[model samples]
Target: MTDRSFLDWPFFEAKHRAWADEVEAWAAAHAARLTDEHDADGSTRALAAAMGEAGLLRAACPADGKLDVRMLCLARDILARHSGLADFAFAMQGLGTGAITLFGCEPARDFLADVRAGRALAAFALSEPEAGSDVAALATTATRDGADWVLNGEKTWISNGGIAGGYVVFARSGEAPGAKGLTAFWVPGGLVRVVERIEVSAPHPLARLAFDDVRIPDSHRIGAAGDGFKVAMATLDVFRATVGAAALGFARRGLDLTVERATSRKLFGAPLFDQQMTQGAIADSAVEVDASALLVYRAAWLKDQGTPRVSREASMAKLHATEAAFRIADRCAQLHGGLGVVRDAAPEVLTREVRALRVYEGASEIQRIVIARAETAR
Candidate 1:
């Protein structure tokens, strides 16, 4: 079980504690089935639907038709600790539907209603073959027609790429080149074609999509013509801290598994936990987990207080937590020796899941750049 002492901190309220407990209980009951890597799309979609049915997804959206970043962070931390797939399911629900919550018009809001109820699976389509962290380099184009817009381009590494019911696509409007020319649109599925679904080490379903003369009504546009950059940034800003929360969850589980194995295994005719080296490793894991929790919750608390932006804090949390999770998982795997490398070990699963967190959202290198730029600007 995770340390409940953090709940006593002033950063969290009674309601937050209650919500965390509920999510933790739900996860304990569901994580086992979702752990199967086979049929990842089926597992993820089922988990998403179950999360929605439990009313937990309601917390993902706010009453003002926006998202509360703090709640998102809390939920991700709780769920990820229990199951990575559960965290993936919940995080995608918010990320895929973020533009709609932040900048969607009346019609867009209506479309998002399906998302809130889990009737629609949504996706964010911003990264292209050439643009990952550098949003300014996106080459997807959207040209205006009589009463519609024609979109053409390819988006790669999109989460829920093949399974999403619809996508919030970002494309250049030709108004101006680079970031200024960008616009966001709500494009329903089947309009765009899935070119390829990339298989990676982790075994989650990700794909590359191609928009060949895809026509969407002007009404599908999310914000102003040149406001795509702002919309994307706003959405990412709200959920950025939650990425750290997810990493923390993975770390906590890795630590727990390590501790359990250490206490049970024997070395030198004594329990492995009795060794000084084992004790030191356990202490290090505990300290890192606490440090990560502090950083992640601090970012969430700041955002919930209505801070305009938290780029510095969010980058710090994502960088530190994700890096820490990788280290914690690696150390745990090492402690497990030959058995750790086996797929069935809990620590091995954590090792695989945590490996990808460092690359997604923004890579560790990109987070460092964000942090350095923010510090210098200050």
Candidate 2:
């Protein structure tokens, strides 16, 4: 129903196209089971398991351990089109375990298998109450003990916080200030306590975590003590574009619902689509969707081509696509008139989901700064 012609773009290979088709089919079959209004956490866990069973998670981590950004984008795009919760489950799995996949020791590999199989939930704990886009401002600390590391700080807004089997926590561990002092640890959920469960407009298993001297074995260290910042940035570089793809999916779905409504609903004794104003809105939605796809796929393609770091491209894609999707969702809601504002309506739900995308990963303001920095450096 959404635009499949984008698959023909040179950005994707034959295998990527095949994988996209397969994922879309799987999502179609499992759409109902992927979302549950009564139990958000349970549904997320179930969706992760289903994705693992369907072998869709293989794209999250290939045999060679190299992350394929294009495949990741494809999966997110398709899954998001079907269910936002499903996309959340899949993205968190990839993100939570990404540090281990890219930099973990042999022991961390064992945890990743559980993650891929959906037997264990994973989370990324980098942001704190005080530190968000400004990673240098993180206050979490990891102090060395005799043979272990003690984490003592709080992480808020963590996805899969209460349910994750383990977390890739970033903390200050050295004398240097800012990001240079940070370290990454793979801490089991048992070591930390869920201080509070965060409820958002678009529900997911988010929580605030408290680490009261949580002890973890030194083996759980992801990289060198000073490598946490690098690890986090690298992981984000790979996933940021996929966020845009997810936004694109939401925008595309909103557009489709709008088209269906306009064509079927009539006003003033004619179809709603008959109005020039309606036509203008539809045209704007189409352009925004296509433009978002172009930016998203471009970033994915460049990452796949072995660009060591794609901060500029990734930020551009995320900023443009997320902003565009929010606007498109708002426009769709406006077009739907009274029905759009009703609870659980397609446009209303999409508006909430798309709004969060603009804030997470890196906010639009941060992305603009990143882009500006890169341009000035050039």
Candidate 3:
């Protein structure tokens, strides 16, 4: 169980605390039974269905059915603390349907209902081979073809790429050069087709999508024709904080496991926890974990309080939490000696998982840039 003390901070309200307890209970009960080793596609689908059955998907979006940053962060933190696969399952459910939740035409609303019901999986397809953090460098283009839009080019490093039922695709809309030319689309995955599913170090679902004149109705556009950048930015602003929350969860798990193991493992006629070195390590981890929690919830609370564009807060949270999670995981591995590197110990899995978080959702370096840009702009 998480330390309830974080709830006492000004960043969280009673409702957030209540939601945390509820999700924590659900996670404790169900996280262990769900394994993600083999049949990744099937496991992800099952995970989503289980999340839906638990009614956690309800919190993935807001009361108005829009994306709620606070709820997303809470769910990710809770689930990621319990299981990385669980967090991944929950995160994709929001990100995949985020565009529709924010801005979709008539048919998009019906599509969102499927997401809430777990009848379908959702994906966000914005990254490409040429574009990782540089959004302005994207080469994918979508043009109007009578009543439909014809899409061309490819999106790589896409989450839930092959498995999701639908995707919020971004492409150049011919408005102007750079970000302004981009537009977002709610394209059904079956309609777009996947080029290949790319395996990563962490073994989560990711793929490359090639749109070869993929025909989508004009009604599929999210926001205006040239507002893809705005839509994508707005969507990221909410979920980015949640990414940090997920990192916080990972760090918390690392701390818990390390503390438990240190107390139990004996060395040189005494428990590892008895050593000053071990105590220092644990203290450092605990402090960092709390710091991560503060940054994460601070961003969440700011958003809940109706602050616009938490780019700096989100960047700070994501950067700190992700970097700290890696450190915590590394320290856990070190504390375990050779056992930590073993697959059975889970640190090995966590090591890979934490590494991925540092890169995705904007890399640690990119986040630094974002924070600096925001600070300087102000």
RMSD of 3: 1.3
- Tens digits of per-residue lDDT, candidate 2, 32-131, equal 6669855789999999899888888877755568889999998988888889999999999899988888886566777788888888889999999999
Give TM per candidate: 0.97, 0.98, 0.97
Best candidate according to TM-score: 2
Winner by lDDT between candidate 2 and candidate 1: 2
lDDT of 3 by residue, 111-180 (tens): 6777777677888888999898998888999999999999999999988888887889999988988999
Highest lDDT, which number?
2
Worst 10 residues of 1 by lDDT: 61-70
Stretches of candidate 3 exceeding 4 Å from the true structure: none
Q: Considering lDDT, which of the candidate structures 2 and 3 is the better prediction for this target?
A: 2
Judged by lDDT against the true structure, how good is candidate 3? 0.85
Q: List, residue by residue over 249-287, the lDDT tens digit for candidate 1.
A: 899998988898898899989899998888999899999
Compared to the true structure, candidate 2 yields what TM-score? 0.98
Over 4 Å off in model 2, which ranges? none
Residue pairs in clash, model 3: none
Q: What is the lDDT of candidate 2?
A: 0.90
